[model samples]
Target chain A: MDCISARSKNIKGKGQSKLKRRESLAGLLFVSPTIIYFIVFFLLPLAVCIYASFTNWNILSPNRVFVGTLNYERLFVDPKFWKALKNTLFMLIPIPIYITFALLFAYACHKNILGQKVFRAIYYLPYISSIVALTLIWMWLFNSKYGLVNNFLSLFVDNPPSWLSDPFWTKWMIVIMISWKLIGFTSIYYIAALKSIPKSYYEAAQIDGAGPRQQFFKITLPLLTPTTFYLLVIGMIGSLQTFVEVQMFAPDGGRGYGVGTIVFYIWQKAFSSSQMGYACAIATVFGLFILVITVIQFTLSRKWVFEGN
Target chain B: MKRKISPVRIIVFIILLIGAVTMIVPFAWMLSTSLKEANLVYTIPPQWIPKPVDWKNYIEIWTASNLLTGIKNSCIISVSVLVFCTFTSSMAAFAFSKLSFPFKNAIFVMLLTTIMVPLVVLLVPLFVIYTKIGWIDTLLPMIVPASMCNINIIFFLRQYMTGLPKELLDAAKIDGCGYFSAYWRIYLPLCKPAIVANVIMLFMITWNDYFGPLVFTHSESKQNIQVAIAMLNSHYIQQTDIPLMMTASLIAILPVLILFIICQKYFTESFAMTGIKG
Candidate 1:
């Protein structure tokens, strides 16, 4: 009887082991396509990009010769690169302003105010619209002669700036265009973050004799830090990569080449100039910049963003 | 529950009212310009409502260029990307969430790392790779690369699937259902809302993308609506037919507006989830 029972137990153990093997096999099979895709698109391209950054190969070049960081050295001295970098960084000036407005709008909406849903939908409109179309509309709106912006401004000021043509206001125009589109999206995110904050906190604060103003500064602002950090990082990354809007508004980079962003510069270099190697070098630097900034932001976020409360 | 309207409430309402109008003016203006005659576009005081509205600009722009073909191509590319991406990402998400495998954490971390790599860095390399594969000027560059694996989508879906009952999957296994079959017959059906929400978001991203189509697609017929409009913008600027350009711009955004209106909830919800997690 002991020998028979032991034999049955061994057979059952084998069956369970077979099932485990099958499950492992199934897991690999399920994830294989994504794994293959990542290798081909993400991994392979990244490796090639890093390598190509050190080479002097054009689009149709038969041979690639290693340049030993020549592209990187030249990039630092290149006026166009500096200009592009400046333009990229300049686009981020509106973040604080955008976040403030978004917070106020979100707070107002979160109050269960009149036309709350309508306000939310209206604010989010530009975010969902095609950027190309919106950029085009803004181009018309910034037209020196008949633009709605100038038309409205003309009523007060004798001379309203030519928003698109003038290099002076080009960055400002780009900032406004980006902020207009992003405000709604930012507000929506803020609203979501606000909703996740428990109401009991506010009730407790009120019982402790906190005024509405005090409640906003102490309770609301502190709690919303995570969302702010998120928006800041995302906003910075996006601003640094400003391309399509800049390209659309100023196809030639506008007067004195003021509106040329880093990504747009990269695009022009690669596609138009066919300087693939140089473009790759710029892209590599740009990518590293983004990654480092993101990492720093992540490291620093713990100081401000409340983890539990 | 009724309370008197405070002055602060009135102030907030006024501020929101102004903000709402500012938000909407662009679309309203785009639509108004689409209806305006060429001469009416540059009036001394721009006409908010165009007199003797010309609806012909829409038909004219459509027939004049590759606008319709661009729309068709956009639909084809986005839908394909949507279907394939959703399927593959969900499968990957399922593996990450449900199944135990060797080096799973390492692979996931590797995947997350790549999300920080800018697409700009990949552009030159991808162009070369695609050219080598003879995919330049083809839709494959746009569709295949995007459909490969969206890190964001995989992460989102995995977070979602983690909350699902593991017992259901176990029950399927006990009922003689294999892993793939269980995922197909049970999880896919159960995750329909999530899948649909992801589809809308992916569709929007794909459709609104201008750069991929601009670089990868050389032929006119292969271009999407955003690319088509951009090409037309430069041409129409020289053509000096502002109304035609405006008309094209309006048409380019129509699908997005319609989709957003229809699926605003899903859109906001998806964004909310992304924000909270990220």
Candidate 2:
């Protein structure tokens, strides 16, 4: 009986090992496509991108002569690059504004307001709609002469300022457009965050003699920090990469560098001018900047984002 | 208990109503303009309703530009990418969530990090590579890379799959069902809701994607709906054919808008799910 039991145990152990191997093989097989894809598209392209940045590679030119940090040097001095960076940074001004509105809207809708569902759907419309369509609609609406915006503004002020043409207003127009596009989407996230906060917390706050304002500040806002931080990080990254709207609104970077984003500049350098190496260098720097910003946001999030224990 | 109609609720409702109007007015204007004749577009008051609603622009847009071809190209690209990527991503997600393998977590984490790498960084290198491969002016550039796998979709689906019962797959395995069969027959059916959510999201994204098509396709025929609309905008802007432009814009947005409305529940719910967990 002892020998038979021992033989059975050995058989079971061998079977288990074989099953484990099969599982491993299957897992790898399942993931193989993704692995191969990442290597070919992501890893290879990234490697080539970094390597090509050091060379004076131009699409028009045959030779990709090694120019070691020269492209970087030129990028740092390029006025268009600086202006583009400034415009990109300047667009971030509306982040807080839109976030505040989004939060407020979320808070309002969270109260189970009448037509809340409809309101939510309406807000999400601009976000899901074609950016090209939205941009064109906005362009027509801001068309200085016939635009509804200027038409309405004319009733109030003598001059509404050429929204698309005037440098100063063009930035604001982009800002308005971005804010309009983002608010609903951001609010949806905020609503989700709001939902996840326990009803007991708000009840506890009420028991502590906290007013609506106090409850919001003390309990609600703190709980919502993680969502806020997430939005901020993504918003910052997205603002830095702003392109389509800028491209459409001011095709030539607007008058005196009004709306050229970092991506737009990189695009122009790479595709328009065929300065592949220079574009790669700009892209590398821009990518690093995004990385650093993301890292910083992550690090900072640890301090502010309330991890509900 | 009869709840009182509070002033606060009223105030909030009023504010939301105003905000909703602001959100909706642009679309309203787009529709209104699309129905107006070109000569009537620049009126002083800006007619909320055109005097004679012209449906001619709608009919004319088909012949006016590459709108029909644009729609076809967009449909091809969006549908193919979503279907193929959804399968690959779900498969990856299944492996990551349920299966045990050496370096699985490490691989997933590495893939997660790649999400942070912006598309711009890869633009130049990809363009060069595509040029070398003669993929320029073709839909392959847009279709191939995306169809490989989407990291976000994989990540989301993994989160979802982790919530599913392990015993189901165990039972299937015990019944002599292979790993692939378990995934396809049991897990895939159970993952319907999540898959539907993901499909809607992916469709919207791929449909609205302009930058990818803009950079990849140079020819008029190869252009996606967004790029085609943009080209139309540039051309028509010179002619000041605002009505025609509006008609084109409306046509471009209609498909996605209809999809969004039909799948409204999934759209908002998916956003909430991903945003919170993410």
Give me the candidate number with maximum TM-score: 2
For residues A94-130, write the lDDT of model 1, one tens digit per residue. 8887888899999988887799899999998888888
lDDT for each residue of candidate 1 in B1-278, tens digit (9 for 90 to 100)? 35349999999999999999999998898889989888888888878888898889977998877889899999989888998899999999898999887778988898878778878988888888899989998888889877877888889889888889999889998899989988889888888878878888888899899988888888998989998888766524567677777888888888877888999888888888777677
Segments of candidate 2 deviating more than 4 angstroms: A1-3, B1-3, B235-237
Candidate 1 residue B66 C-alpha distance from true site, Å: 1.7
Question: Evaluated with lDDT, which candidate comes out highest?
Answer: 2
**True contacts reproduced, candidate 2:** 0.84
- Give DockQ for candidates 1 onward, in order: 0.75, 0.82
Cα lDDT of model 2 by residue, A1-309, tens digit: 999999999999999999999999999999988998889889999999999999999999898899999999998899999999998888898799889999999988887788888999999999999899999999899999989999999999998899887877888998899899999999999999888889998898889899999999999999899889989988988887889988888888888887788999999988889999999999999999999989988998888899888
lDDT of each: 0.86, 0.90
User: Model 2 chain B: which ten-residue window has the lowest total lDDT?
Assistant: B231-240
lDDT of 1 at B112: 79
